[model samples]
Target: MTLLSLFTQARTYLKHRPYPVLLMAATPGSSFAALPGAQAPTRGTGTSFLQTFQNYAFDGFTLIGLCLCAFGIILVGRHALGVYHEIHMGKAKWADLGSTAVVGVCLIGVTIYLVTTASNIL
Candidate 1:
């Protein structure tokens, strides 16, 4: 109902769903799994320690990037929906709306930059 309650609900939701935020903050290495000299000797084996580690590391990076992008999209959508709801209910002021819009745009820009940079590195 009230602005404070709305914010509190959002905060609670974020607190509960922290994995996305964690993934968004992750900084996995840039190297791919099968580097020229990094591959284990027993390449055709079921599972070698080096191969497994490399595979997991590469997968972690990919997963983190995907999660970060998804989180950013979800965050922007949630904020936009919240703003729309507030406006529809006549509870959002012009200044509040403007500030929210600015923050959302900045967030989207940063998210795009991060995803693009990560993609390029990989």
Candidate 2:
């Protein structure tokens, strides 16, 4: 089978098994323990609700970044599972390639967003 076939299969699998796949993808965040003393620096700054909202919007961008990265990793894992199935059947070699390439593209987009952050000083 061609590389395109593998990608097609991966896409079909993702489309059909979205719930379990998404659940597995989200599982990693479960192990992330909250750190102590991680409160905002402005907690006692006596800011109004509006100021607090603005601070959360700014600081919360990191959360968005983390979610995007997690999504990409999940996609890669889903694709790997498909490849594993195909391998056991003694079929195509390109099945996993398509899923991994798409994952690479996702990583590139996430990297671009991270690098272009408004607060990036470096």
Candidate 3:
């Protein structure tokens, strides 16, 4: 396959990953049902799609989750780029390369926490 095609597939795959899906769904205008297993709020006339969506999307937990997921993707991608440069161009210092891997792992951990906790919070 062409390099561009590979890149496109990679991007598409990343966007659909669970963390990214949760992050995107947390954005305003996205739909949210009462989170699974949560007791529904009593006594409301019921919520419009937009309102229900906004309510969850703007909540603190979802916002934090989205941030974490986004940071994870960026860090991981940056680390990969560093590795590529180190291998092909020999332009990155060993310490810089190593630091990228460290940051990437940390970001992944944080992302997992944020995503799982956000689901519970909803």
Candidate 4:
């Protein structure tokens, strides 16, 4: 059939899947590993609780910062397009376009800062 209908059928089939059963089947030891008093798995790095919490918190903040930066880029791009159109129609000027470009560049720069800070958390 058509591509749209095929995608619709696939989406419908996947939406109602038995996720827990599939997850259990995917991991052969899932059911047996749910023992009482079982120790949770660790990477054996021996980091302290406070250090781990700091790492996780910083990582989450970095992720959120990066996401906001990307969203800013999208907003700037949309606004820049409108500014350009307005300039073309004589409703605005080149200064607005330049400002949009500057803001867009600054937002993308923040994304780079976030990525770099991920290695220096705390």
lDDT of 1 by residue, 81-104 (tens): 888789879998667777887898
Q: Candidate 3: worst 10 consecutive residues by lDDT? A: 38-47
TM-score of each: 0.47, 0.43, 0.38, 0.48
The model with the greatest TM-score is 4
The lDDT ranking, best first, is 1, 4, 3, 2
- lDDT values of the candidates? 0.76, 0.69, 0.71, 0.75
Task: Please list all clashing residue pairs in model 4, or write none if there are none.
Answer: none
Alpha-carbon RMSD of each model:
19.9, 20.1, 17.5, 10.5
Those runs of model 3 whose alpha carbons end farther than 4 Å from true positions after fitting are 1-71
Write one digit per residue (lDDT tens) for candidate 3, span 1-122. Answer: 99999999988898778797777878755454545575433323246876665555546556677776887788699767868687677676777767877877887887788687766756
**Runs of candidate 2 exceeding 4 Å displacement:** 1-38, 41-48, 94-122
Residues 1-122, candidate 4: write the lDDT tens digits: 99999999888877887696578688977766867883332323237887666656666676676787778778878888999999989999898899889888887787678767764653
Better of 1 and 4 by lDDT: 1
**On a 0 to 1 TM-score scale, where does candidate 4 land against the true structure?**
0.48
Q: Which portions of model 1 show Cα errors greater than 4 Å?
A: 1-52, 118-122
Model 1 accuracy (lDDT, Cα)? 0.76
